[model samples]
Target: MKPEDIQIGKLVRKTETSSPLVECFDMKTNTCPIYMCCGLKGALSQAVGAFYGALDRYTLEDVITSENRAMLQHILLRSKLQPAAGDQDEVPDLMQGVP
Candidate 1:
């Protein structure tokens, strides 16, 4: 399937700014606040890293390797959607930068 064809939760009619981060709505439940719910985070991060690396004219062999792509796929598979019960709480860990 194409990248766009891959359903990472819902597209969320509202599109945020261009970056590694993307905001999506949980169609399964509407009461949930705006939170990160997509499976494309790892892949998106790698892509951004690559773009910046290229723009800076860096010649690193491992930057765009197949292993990096596989890592992204793994992250997507491991991330499961578990709804939040009770009040809307903020998760500070989600704000951490990519390693």
Candidate 2:
């Protein structure tokens, strides 16, 4: 399917996980002192889950729309880190009208 044909808003799914950073931390070496009573880990996990859920709603086309493209360009120009001259040409010409 064409990128533009997909609906950006429909891809997101909301779900919660009971364990947050438990999988990341090693029990033997990186064990948290308050592992048993730590609410922060679960909360952090839920926050990350929510972030991904929100991000899932956008398609490539939705993110690269004309308005968004312009906004991105504007932000990039305003930022201190400018793209290299050679790298500028590597950017996809998504602004071009597709047949």
Candidate 3:
């Protein structure tokens, strides 16, 4: 699908990340006594808007390139096979970075 066809902001609208950039942004749920006077909320709101705007500009098509997908699969597989952080040296290089 085209990037603009995807609305990530709408998809995540009910999540905490949708508007809780600062407690002051959500009046109904905000418990902070000084929320009315908090100037930081405006800046944070703008920042969050920009964040969602950026996310909404792209689709999964923009992120999951084959090369990157293969790399991610390799990393996930490597994690499953490795013993522990300290035993990383003993882990085999499975697929030699291929998936």
Q: Which stretches of candidate 1 lie over 4 Å from their true place?
A: 1-21, 24-37, 58-99
> Of 1 and 2, which scores higher on lDDT?
2
Which candidate number maximizes lDDT?
3
List per-prediction Cα lDDT, in the order shown: 0.38, 0.51, 0.57
RMSD, one per candidate, in order: 16.0, 9.6, 11.4
Give the winner by TM-score: 1 or 3. 3
TM-score of each prediction: 0.24, 0.40, 0.51
lDDT of 2: 0.51
Candidate 3, residues 1-99, lDDT tens digits: the string is 233343556434433334466666677888998777878777887897898888777654455567687776667566754344343234333334243
Alpha-carbon RMSD, candidate 1 = 16.0
Q: Candidate 1, residues 1-99: lDDT per residue as tens digits?
A: 234232222212112222223333233444425345645655766875665555444222224356575675566447733323342432222112223
What are the per-residue Cα lDDT tens digits for candidate 2 across 42-92? 687788667777776666476676656777666645653323344432322
lDDT of candidate 3 at residue 37, scale 0 to 100: 81
Q: What residue pairs clash in candidate 2, if any at all?
A: none
Distance from true location, Cα of 77 in model 1, Å: 50
Cα deviation at 49, candidate 2, in Å, is 1.1
